[model samples]
Each structure stands twice: as structure tokens, then as C-alpha cells.
Target chain A: AQSVAQPEDQVNVAEGNPLTVKCTYSVSGNPYLFWYVQYPNRGLQFLLKYITGDNLVKGSYGFEAEFNKSQTSFHLKKPSALVSDSALYFCAVRAQPYTGGFKTIFGAGTRLFVKA
Target chain B: DVKVTQSSRYLVKRTGEKVFLECVQDMDHENMFWYRQDPGLGLRLIYFSYDVKMKEKGDIPEGYSVSREKKERFSLILESASTNQTSMYLCASSLRLALLSYNEQFFGPGTRLTVL
Candidate 1:
């Protein structure tokens, strides 16, 4: 079974400081990972995905994630955090439709709070 | 730009009431998904449709059913609305073609359902 784990329930960071939201996955063979962000009263927005590409993938809103094959981790990062950047972050693993079906398993989520 | 729209932003229902949550996508996507979002649990897939009338059960499909009569629209049905089922419902769509580079799912604004 493909699954994702986000260890942090909440993360606090100051504005202009680097921020990291941790994610790890367990899957057979290669894994397809994704990052999503949700704001207050809004649906989730896709940040980035790692299908089969460069380990370092850049996403929207000055966000990026590094896919570590050895560590089985895909962590979302930002060079500088902003107050507006505070939101709920989710990590997901895409399941190949052949084995089971086209299902994506998401992590429990990490609430990021950026202080101004 | 792909756009996914949900029927409502907020809803209030009573116990044992039948509830319908509708989702529509402007893009001609082959795969449509329904997920419920809770505070800590990021998103749990309730059901997914690969094509018209072809629905698949997701991680948490209990107490809920889905309909995909047309390619562009997918409807989630709650047979008997329960307090536990009260959560934010999100609709998303994506192209099924694995060969396509852009397989990211586009999401709707989400509908917050309160069952009392």
C-alpha cells in the first residue's frame, strides 16, 4: 500500500526565515509524490508533483520540494516565509491504477504558522 | 485554465436526510474525484470516477455513494447524513492519460456540510 506521513502537526516560523514541511512516503517501486496547500475556507491547491524528474522540483508561490529517493522523503521548502504563506500543507502519494486503482493517499497534514 | 466548481459553499442538513453534493469541471477530464477534508486529516477520498458511469470506491466510501452520469459532472450522495459525516467536501478532476505531462488534479472551492 502506498501511504504518506507528515510528522509535524504544526510548524512555527518567522517571516523571512526558511521553512520546511516534512513528508515521507512508503510505496513499492518508484513513487509519485505531490504537495498541496489549503487556505482558510478554501480548497486545496496543488503546489507541485514529482512523477519522474529532477529531484528538486519548483512549485507555485515560491515553493519547492526535494524528492529524496534514499530517504523516501519529499519535503516542501521555501527560502523565505511570509505571513500569508501560513496554511495547511498536505503530502500525497499517487497509486498506480493498474495494481489497485487511481487513488491518492494523503498525509494527515501539517499546519504552518508564519509569524510576522 | 482548468476550473472545477461545486454546487454549494455551505450546507446544513438534518440527520437521516439525503444529501447531494455536485461537482463539475470545465476541463474534459477523464478522472473525477470526491474527497472529504477534516481538521487534522488532510483529505480522504470518498469515491472516484474514471469515466462516465464508472465509479470506484476510495479509502472512505462507507455511508456515501456517488454518481457520474455525464463526463463533466460527478455527484456524491449521502444516504443518511450523520454528524460524523459533517466535513468539508472537495471535488477534483484530472486527465487520465498517464502519457500527459500535466496530470495534476484541479480542485473546486469545496462545500462545507454540517449535519445536525
Candidate 2:
């Protein structure tokens, strides 16, 4: 089974400071990881993904994530936090099993509060 | 640009009432998915369809069903709305590309359902 875990329930950061949201995953096969953000009353917006490329993957809104194989983690990061960036962050992992059917498993989201 | 739209922004229903949540995607994608988002649960897949008229149960499909009679439209059905089922429903569509590059899943704005 493929599953993800977000250790933090919430994270607080000052505007202009760097931000990080942690996530770890367990999958049977190769990992296809993703990061998404959600605002209040809205759905998720794709942030970035890691398939087989560079460790650091850049995504929308100046967000990025690093995939660490040894640690089994894919943590979302931003160089400088913005107050508007306060929202919920989700980390998802796809189990690339040889089986034809597969689904993405998401972590219990982490709420981010960026203070102005 | 790929866009996904949900039929309603908010809905209120009583117990034992039948509820329908519709989703449409502008992109001609082959895969459509329905997920429920809770505060700490992040997102749990309720159902998914790989093609027209083909649906598959997801992680949490116990109280819900899905319809995908057409390529662009997917509808989630709740036979009896329950208070525990009150949550934000999100729809997503994505092309079934190679496993290495299929992490991009476009999502709708989501519908908030409250069951009394």
C-alpha cells in the first residue's frame, strides 16, 4: 500500500522568511510524488512533482520540493514566505506498481500560517 | 489551459437525502477522480474513472458512488447524506500519460457539502 505522512499539524513562519513543510511516504514501487496547496473554500492547486528528475523540483508560486530517497521524504519549501501563502499543504505519493490500476495517496495536510 | 469546474460551491442536505455533485473538465482527459477533503485527513479518493462508463472504487468509496457516462463529465452520488460525510469534495482530471510524468492532476474549485 502507498501512504504518506505529514508530521506537522501546523507551521508558522514570518513573511520573507524561508518555509518548509515536511512529508514522508511509503510505497511498494517507484514513487511519483506531488505537492498541492489549498486555500479556504477552494480546491487544491498543484505545486510541484518529482518523478525521476533533479532532487529539487521548482513549481508554481515560487515553491519547490526536494525528493530524498534515503529519507523517504518529499518536503515542500519556499525561499521566502508570503502572507498570502498561508493555507493548507498536502503531499501525495503514487505507487508505481506494475499493476494497471493505481491511485495517489495524500498525507494528512499541514496548515501553514505566514504572518505579515 | 486545462480547467475543471464543479457544479455547486456549497450544498446543504438533510439525513437520508440523496445528493449529487457534478464535475466537468474542459480538457479531454481520460482519467477523472473524486476526492473528499477533511481538515486533517487531507484528501481521500472516493472514486475514479479511467474512461467513459468505467468507474473504479477508491480508498473511501463506502457511502458514495460515481457516474461517468461521458468523457467530460463525472458525477458523485451519495445515497444517503450523513453528518460524517459533510466535507469538501474535489474533482480532478488528468491525462493517463506514462507513469514517470503523470503527476499533473488539475482540480476543480471544490464543493462544500454540509449534511444535517
Candidate 3:
């Protein structure tokens, strides 16, 4: 079984300031991590994914996440925050099973509040 | 651009009433999924279909059923809607079965259902 943990329930940041949302995971095999954002009453939008690549992975809306193997963490970061960035973010992980398809597990979600 | 569309944006139902939430994807993707999103629970998979008429149970399948009569459409059915079942439902589609190359899912705008 695979699980993802997002420690922060809410993160506040000022405009133009950098922001980080922490995430960690527990899985049996290679990890396929993902980040998604959801606005009020909207569905989740895929921001990025880390399948197998360099540790630092860049995503949409000027967002990026770092995959730390030893730390078992994948933290989402943005150099500058925008008021439009205020939303709910979720971290997810799926193990690459030998049985053909993968089942993704999602975290509890982190609410980001970016103030201008 | 690929788009996933849900039939309803907002739904109001009562307990013991049967509910149907429909989703369609225009990309002709091989995999389709249904998930329920809560305030803090993030996204929990209810069911997924890899192909037409083939469904698999996801994390939370109890009290919920799904149908995929066509490859482009997936339907989620709640035999008895409860207060606990009131949440935002999301639909997503992804391409798979191609040997695990990097594949991302496209999501719909979501359907907000309320069971009283």
C-alpha cells in the first residue's frame, strides 16, 4: 500500500514571496508523485508529476517540486506567490505495480492563501 | 486541448435517493476515473474503468457503483445518497497501457453534490 502525507493544513504567503508546501510519502516500490490544485468548487488540476527524472521538477503556474529520495519528500515550491494562487493543493503518489495499471493515493490537501 | 466534462455542476439530493453523476472525456483515453473530493480528505477514488464495460473498485467503493457503457463516458451511481456522501465529485481521464511512459490525467470541472 502507498500513502501520501501533507503536513500543512494552511500556508499563508505574501505576494512576490516564495512559498513551499511540504509533502511526504510511503510506498513499496518506485514512486510516481504528483501535485494538483483546486479552486473553489472546482475539480483538481494537474500541476506536475515526478516519474523518473532529475530531483528538481518544474510544473505549471511557475510551480516546482523536489523529489528527495532519502527524505521521502516531495515539496512544492514557487518563487513568487500570486493572489490567484490561493487554492487547495494536494500531493499524491502511486506505486508502479507489476500488474499493468497503477492506483494513485492522495494526501489530505494543503490550503494555500496568497495575499497581495 | 483535451477536455473532461461532467454532466452536473451542482446537485441536491435527499437520503435514500439514487444519484447518477456522468462524466465524459473527449480525448479517447483508455483509462477513466471517478473521485470524490472533500474539504480536507483531498480526492478519494470511487471507481475506475480501464476500458468499456470494465470497472474496478477504488479506495471507497461502498455504497457507490459505476458504469462505463462507452469508452468516452463513465457514470457513477450512488444507491443511497447519505449526508456523508455529500461532496464534490471529480472525473478524470488518462492514457495508459503503453508500457508506463509518462502519462498525466486531465480532469473535469467537477460536480458538487449535496445530500440532505
lDDT of 2 by residue, A23-96 (tens): 99999767889999988877888889998869999999999999999999999999999999999999998766
* Per-residue C-alpha lDDT of model 1 across residues B75-109, encoded as one tens digit per residue: 99999999999999999999887633237788999
- Give the per-residue lDDT digits (tens) of candidate 1, residues A1-116: 67899999999999999999999999877788999998988888999999886999999999999999999999999999999999999999876663334778899999999999
Provide the lDDT at A70 for model 2.
96
Global Cα RMSD, each model: 1.6, 1.5, 1.5
Residue-pair clash count for candidate 1: 0
The count of residue-pair clashes in candidate 3 stands at: 0
Tens digits of lDDT, candidate 3, B59-94: 899999999999999999999999999888999999
Looking at chain B only, the TM-scores across the models are 0.96, 0.96, 0.96
Instruction: State residue A109's C-alpha deviation in candidate 1, in Å.
Output: 0.8
Each prediction's whole-model lDDT (CA): 0.91, 0.90, 0.90
Best by lDDT: 1
